[model samples]
Target: MTRSPLVLLGKIWLALILVFLYAPILVMAAMSFNASPFYQLPFQFSTDWYAKMAGNQQIITAAIRSVLIACGTTVIATCLGTAASVALFRYEFRGKRILQVLLFPPIAIPWLITGTAMLVFFFAIGIGRGTPAVVIGHVALALPYVIVTVSARLSSFDVTLEEAARSMGANAWTVLSRVTLPWIAPGIVAGALFAFAVSFDQFVVSYFLSEPGDSTLPVLIYTAIRKGFTPEINAISTIIVTVSMAVMFLAARFSKFGGSR
Candidate 1:
């Protein structure tokens, strides 16, 4: 059998790109298992770092905080974004396009800028910095992703289903719950997963919005790194990366991200 040169080149390029993107993460994950606290040569395996990470009160607290914030963000963002997506899908009105366009800034703009703006705005409004502020910022950041994901799934929805349900005396709520929601359930799940991942992995916004004494995992990791790099940091980072990857994998599976709808 013969293969085209271009196809081979493209495969080779993709391989290189994957290596470049994931090599550091793979190295870090491997190093987490290494016994060397300073990450020296021989690479003796040990689970001491994981055990230490489990015991560290600071890390445990930060991890719990991050999980709670992520869950809260997922719920809020998914609800709000799903409602917005349904409205955008079902109705037309003045400023609708403007509203849709507005979803981009949180996504298109860098988190650094968004985080700084949120910090300033919250301070002016007296919210200051805390878990509450971080949750708000995470929801805002996650909303666009949920909206976009749900809207994509909504694109394939049949409008007649709602009309048919309504003709059968189904109220708005009934139709929404019975007809519309089922069709878009996968999207909702995917969007929620995405929201969780966004909030869980979020650093810049959490860093800016969180209090010094109560920081999220990402912020805590940043603080730890400032002091020094240790196997404990690597272990925690590996856990974060693993969770993020799992979340994204579920999202993609539910959303059919790369496949035909």
Candidate 2:
């Protein structure tokens, strides 16, 4: 069969889009290794920036805190968002639409507004700013992402398997735990990883919520950048970009929707 002109054009368009998106990252990664202090270099290569980043204890501490906060937010958001998605998709419930909309406001709201609201809410509730505040902020921010991802997976899911389990004397909880969970496990896992990455890379929320010593990696990077645009910042940025790409690639690879089985 001969391909149509429209199909050929569409393929070209997609290829262009992919190039547009990934080109900058490739350039940034390359520049991270440039030995020159300026963007226009004598083209020398060095690992000095990477070494400096490795020696920066503050960045390491900030990264550790970011991991801890991201883990907490991922756990909370994944559980709540997955449960909400499963319930909404699998069962008929009253006010389900309203609840769904409520869960998604964080995505709709501007990050600045969300950060301000979180700060206010935390203070009003007498929760002092720190990891606790960051946890709450990241959880709220990531819940919408989790809900969207899992719900999309569930939308394409086969419910007959769940019904079969129920007919075999499995209770609602049993069906969910055994049948439904396995089918959508990839989506849940992917969403959880995305949520963790979002929390890990978060800057605005952490900036607003964190105490003096509770800076996340992004916040630390920002502070470092403000001090001066050092080559070490490029190194950190390259590392972060590399790690994020690896994570997202792995998440997609493990997804059943991606045909990994």
lDDT (10s digit) by residue, model 1, range 210-250: 99979999999999999986899999999999999999999
- Which residue runs of candidate 1 sit more than 4 Å off their true CA positions? none
Cα lDDT, all candidates: 0.96, 0.85
Output the number of the lDDT-best candidate: 1
| Model 2 global lDDT (CA atoms, 0 to 1) | 0.85
Candidate 1 weakest lDDT stretch, 10 residues: 252-261
**Candidate 2, 77-159: lDDT as tens digits:** 99999988988897787998898879767887778898988889889989968888899889989998888889988988888
TM-score of 1: 0.96
Candidate 2, run of 10 with poorest lDDT: 252-261
Backbone steric clashes in candidate 2, count = 0
The deviation in Å at residue 200 for candidate 2 is 1.8
Cα-based lDDT at residue 168, candidate 1: 93
